[model samples]
Every structure is written in C-alpha cells, then in structure tokens.
Target: MKVIDTVLNVLWLLLCGIWMALGYFLAGIVCCIFIITIPFGIASFRIAGYVLWPFGRTTVERPDAGAPSCVGNVIWLVFAGWWLVLAHIATAIALAVTIIGIPFAWANLKLIPISLMPLGREVVSTDEKFGGR
Candidate 1:
C-alpha cells in the first residue's frame, strides 16, 4: 500500500474501523449460530477484515461467484445487514461532524453497500490497479 493509504487506514481504524468491524463480527457470530447460515457468517467475517483497514483496498464482484451467494446476501440483508447499515450511517454522521474526521466519514459511507450485500465480492489491493497484486 502507498504511504498515504497506510496513513488514512490507520486513522480510519482509530476513528471508525474498530467499531464497524465489531459490528460485522457480531453479525458473523449471529449468522454462525445456525447451520444454514454459515456462508453468510463467513462473508460477514470477510467483510469484517476489509472494514478494519479499508483505504488501500477495493471490493470487486467475483466472476465465479454464483446464485447461492446472491440468495445468501438477501437472507443476510433481511436478517442482520440492515442494522449494520444503520450503524454505518450513524457513525458517518458522527464522523462528519468533525473536520479531521471528514475523510473517515466518506470511508464509512463507502462501506454501506458492502454491509448490505457482502457476498460475491472480493477485496483486492489498490495496487492491482497498476497490474500488480
């Protein structure tokens, strides 16, 4: 990751990433309680890691991921995703209130879509944009 991305990520982790990741972790735990929801649980955990230090990473649709992921995402959204989205929005509002936190607030808003539909997405390094992984 670039120096700027690293700095932004560290700041984000301090200001909002920890709380957002915790939200995802809690959602993952809930999803894991049932056998049928294990996939959603896994996806939630994956998203949790991405939320932790998000500045240098971006989410892309996985070409090989199929219908099951879509179905799981719907179930996830109905069950726990909405609450996480609300949390993100609330956090964004709080962060936006401070000048220093404005960038983090934007990052928080960027996470809402993934919070709502995490399946079928893979987090890749921004360096991949330059043909390197």
Candidate 2:
C-alpha cells in the first residue's frame, strides 16, 4: 500500500499536485502578509503540503476544536476558502473527463471540505485512526 501510495503521489504531483500546492502556498503567503491572519496562513501552508502529496494521508477533526474554529472557518470561507473550493471542483471536473483520471477526481472532491474549513483539522497518515491523536 505504501508503494502504491508513492506511485500515485508521484503521478498526482506530476499531473496536478504541484499546481494545487502552489495555489495554496500563494494563499498562505497572501494571508501571512497581514498581522491578523497568521493562523489562517499557517493552515494554508500545512494544507499546501497535504495537497502536494496526499495519497497516504487524511484529515481529521480535532476533538478540542470549538466555537472559535467555527468562527474562523466562516471567516476563511468568506475570504479565501471559496476560491479553493472552486479550484478543487474545477480540477475534479476536468480530471473526471478522463477514465484514467477518475481516482484523482474523486480525491479532489474529497478534499473540498478540508479546503473549505481548514481550521481545527489535523492532517494525519491514513494508518492513524481518527481521534488517535
């Protein structure tokens, strides 16, 4: 499974991961430019790494996340999250048109929620059970 993940990740990187990760990185940099949004910038950078090599990993909700996270996510959705969601959706649609790209398209769709609400989520290896943190 690890080897398969490696292969898929390499292919994904070649096909679209690099571009998606760059978009996240750009968003991070933009967010970091303002003093108030450093946390959102950090989340963007973290998600950028996940976008780069996503095959063997998954995102899980943090048990301790509370109302603050919800509020932050709402803010994110308004400012930047919607753009990321649209990018993922567009990428998915394009990938879905090719039979060989079906799995990648599915993966892109799976990423929408996390991209939309990155606050209070943790990225973990798929080997780790949710809440194992």
Global lDDT of each model? 0.90, 0.93
- Cα RMSD to native, each candidate? 1.3, 1.8
Clashes of each: 0, 0
lDDT of 1 by residue, 1-133 (tens): 3888989988888998899899999988988999988888999999999999898888989999899889888988899989999999999999999999888888899899999989999998877755875
The list of candidate 1 runs beyond 4 A from truth reads none
Q: Of the candidates shown, which would achieve the greatest lDDT relative to the real structure?
A: 2
**Candidate 2: Cα lDDT at 129:** 53
Q: What is the TM-score (0 to 1) of candidate 1? A: 0.94
User: How far out, in Å, is residue 48 in model 2?
Assistant: 0.5
lDDT, candidate 1, residue 11?
89
Which residue window of length 10 is worst by lDDT in model 1? 124-133
- Residue 64 CA error for candidate 1 (Å)? 1.0
